[model samples]
Structures are given as structure tokens and as C-alpha cells.
Target: MRNFDQWLSEMRPSINEYNFYVNFEKVYANVDSMKVELNILNSLVGSKDIEQDFREILKRYPETLRCIPTLLAVRQHEIYAQDEEGAFLYDFSRMNYSVEQYIAFMKKTGLLSLIGEHIINNLVDYCLGIETGLDSNARKNRGGHQMERLVEVYLKKAGLEYYKEMYLTQIEQTWGVDLSAISAEGTSTKRWDFVVKTDQRIYLIETNFYSSGGSKLNETSRSYKMIAEEAKSIPDTEFVWITDGGGWKSARRNLHETFDVLEHLYNIADLERGIFNSIFV
Candidate 1:
């Protein structure tokens, strides 16, 4: 047996190797995809007469209305709002009401002022800023990918063939095993991060790396422990959990509980020491 305390101490604080946090390539592609409608709205950038200019733009290109929601960093086509005046649900996908209602929405939401007062010099650059703000929300997801990507490289180096983002149905169907215990319902779904096959057994893998302390670490540790416990009843399967991060320092009790039950729990330090060759062999 190895020392869990020592293992936790050796875990990496982060796996970020790249300086560019937000994926600008994805952002630029998004902007390019909606260029036509964006240029239509660009007509309002420096309008001395915004009201009529906006009305004329809408008259010529009604589809531009769909892009309005995203201008405010909103992803949905319908936005619900209420004021002392009354309640309203503005649908940008199409004209849900008279031009007057949308104009009211624009005025109420400050879109009109933002355009009329020349707050934005160019629509593309302004939306790039909004898209950048929106992409920041993807940082957590990107952090998850960083760990998975790093693990994949090591797995490849170890010469193990694997499946990525595998679900219960596919694994059970392919291997002739059962995993209804983990599914919320028989017909519903659960996915493992990766699955590796060795000559002796199949390894169901879960991987994550947290950079900071959080309430989620405790819950995650507990949940994966339950998964490991349930997975034992399924034959020819081994549950391997690979998790790291200084965040686990704050959630030590639950992590310790998991560490006690799980023989295959490992951190990046283990990977660096070429633990995969031992486990898969």
C-alpha cells in the first residue's frame, strides 16, 4: 500500500501548459459564422439617427433580430422580463410583436442607448468582447479537458487501447456485462470518462483535476466512492479513479474515505512514475 497523505501532497496544482486561456480560434469561427447578420447590425454603430436606422435595417433584414439576444451575452432566443409597467417575453427568433414592442425592449435593455450613444465603435469588435466573456464560462470545462488530454498521452505511451466518453449501454453491449446499478434508470444513461482494456480485465476510468478549493470536491469524492462500491458487483471490471488538485486538501475527510475504499485511486504523481504500465500489465 502507498501513503495517501504523501500522494495528496505530491499532486499538481494545475495542468495548464498553454498561456491562452480562452480558445480564440473557436471565438473567431463563431463570429465569422454570423458575419452577415452582425454586419447588418453594424449599421447602428455610429448612427446619428438610430431609431429609423434600426427600423430600416430590420425592414431589409429581419433575420438580424435573432442575433439580438447574443449581443447582450445571452444564448437563448427568448428572454423574459418584467417591470412596473408589465411583463413581457421577448422572442428574438422572429417578430413576436409589433416593431414598437421590440423597440421598447431595446430601450428597456439599453441596447438602443448602447448603439445610439456610439458606445461601441464597431459591432464585430464589441461582440468579440462579449464572446470572450462568454468563453470565460468554458474555463472549467477546459480545465477538465486538460487533465483528460494529459492522461490520454500517457495511456498511449503505455500502449493501452481505450475508449473515450463511453456510456453504460455501449460498454455493456460490447462486453456482455451489466451496469444498471449506476444508471439512474434502466433506460437512462451514465458515462465514464475513459475505458481501457487489458488481456485480463476491463478498466472503467474516471479522471479530474481541480486547481482550487471548492464545495464540489467533497461531493465528487463521495460520488466516485459510491461508484466504486457498486462497480465491484460487475464481473471483469475494475474502477480506476485518477484525481488531483490542491482543492482535495480542503475536502480531505471525504477524499480519505474514498482513498480507503479504492485501491486504484491515483494522482498525477503516480502517472509521472509510470504507474499505468504496472496497472495495465
Candidate 2:
């Protein structure tokens, strides 16, 4: 049996400087039960005529099961010897691998074609050298940037132009106002996510999409508070916060108290129907 620790030591220098990788190797090496299981898998796969049932094999060789999917995915690209069908088996192998593991495997295999189509297509095109797709990691650094891009496209297709127009057009037609006037000086500190100005008063608008709950929410909240404090400096200016992300279900109440006016999509529709009257009135 290959000493797992020795194998990991040989590969350690090539791995990224992340502690997680080190911890993963340590955990795998120290687990004696897992090591025994791996020996059984090695013996099973070594057989030639023994008809192997994957589930049955998995029962005895559970430790090796984790690597099977990755091996299958690599087979798709024929990184190993070509399968009987001559089709790449890598995809089949990767059925159970995590996204990161799949990506790492692709990188190791130098299968640019498969990587470009499967992983890069979903990540930010910039990171993967693609020209057209949105950066899946751009919005507040969440990993699901591709999913968010899809959502944005869907919202646009659904005739939700008001949301887009709010950012593009500084003027709020219903309220007979333009938010751009609130921070007319346009200092670094005055930059806000959204802003509107009416004949009666100026308003600063801060917008956020909270897909996941963590540092992103805290960072966004901090940004909003900064914008709010900046808006407050202007005597008559009001601060309005507009945020709608799936994570709002968990964070709505906490956020409401932090901002002067907090509105979700439901409130956005109502506010649009009533125009500025719902807010100002």
C-alpha cells in the first residue's frame, strides 16, 4: 500500500497555499478505517473478469468511492486509457466530484476544451479567458456569479426594465425628481449605489442583492451605512435603501432598522405604482 502521507508530501509543493488542502490530506491519512476501505477498492478494481457492481463495491471500499467520480470525469477526456466505447469517460467519472474538485481535475489534465465549455462557461469569462459571459464571481465576490447573471437576464426578459432604468436614468419620473442632485459635489465619499432628488428634497438610494448570508451582507450593510451617513450630511436629503436578494428572507428585519426606507421587490412595485407619493406622502 502506498503511504498516503508520502504521496501527500510529494504533492504538497504543487498545491495552492491554502490550509484546507493540508488539513484534507492529514484527515485522509490518519483515518485508519478509510485506509482499509481503500485497500479493498484497489483489490476489486484490479480484477479482470469479476463483474463489479459499483454500489456493492462501494459498500466495502467507501474511502475509494470519493475518488471514483473524479477518475470517471478524467476518463471523459481520455486522460487515462480510452474506455471500450472510445468516448471520453471523464464526465461520467466526475458525477460525484465537487465543483472545485472538478475544476482542479480539469486544470491538471490540460483539457482546455472540456474546461472551457463546462466550468469556464459558468465562471466569469474573464477568469477563464472567455470573451462574452459575465463574471460569475463579480457580484460581492459570491461564487455563484454565473447563476446571478442568469437571474439578471431572466429579470430583464420578464420586462422588469424599471429596475434597470432606475440605475441608468438618474431621473425618477413619478416623483418629478432626479437623484443625481443629492451628491452633486460627487466626492469619493458621496458615491452611492442609487440617488434621487425632488423639488422638495434630495435622497440617496442604496441597493444590494443578498444571495448568501455572510461577509457579503456585512460588507453591503457597512457600505449602505457609509452612504447613509454621507447623505445625512446634506441637511434635507433622505436615504432610501432598496435591496432584494434571496437572502433577504433571513436578513430583512435586521436591515430594515438600519436604513431609513427599506423596500423589497413587492414594495418596489407598489412604490412604482403610487410613484413618489407612497414614499414622500
Residue-by-residue lDDT tens digits, candidate 1, 150-268: 88988999999899999889998988877776665567577889999877788999999888888899889999999889878878788999988888898888999999998799988
lDDT of 2 by residue, 1-281 (tens): 33323322221111122332233333333333334443444443323322333344544444444443332331122244343434333343224444444344444554333333332232222212221112222323433333333334434444332232243133344454434443444333334444444456655544444554665666666656555655555555576665444554454444544443323222233233443444431
Candidate 2, after superposition: displacement of residue 198 in Å? 2.3
- Tell me the TM-score of model 2: 0.32
Badly placed stretches (over 4 Å) of model 1 are 17-20, 178-190, 214-216, 222-236
Superposed on all Cα atoms, the candidates' RMSDs to the truth, in angstroms, are 3.0, 20.2
- TM-score of each model, in listed order: 0.85, 0.32
- Candidate 1 CA-lDDT value: 0.85
The deviation in Å at residue 20 for candidate 2 is: 32
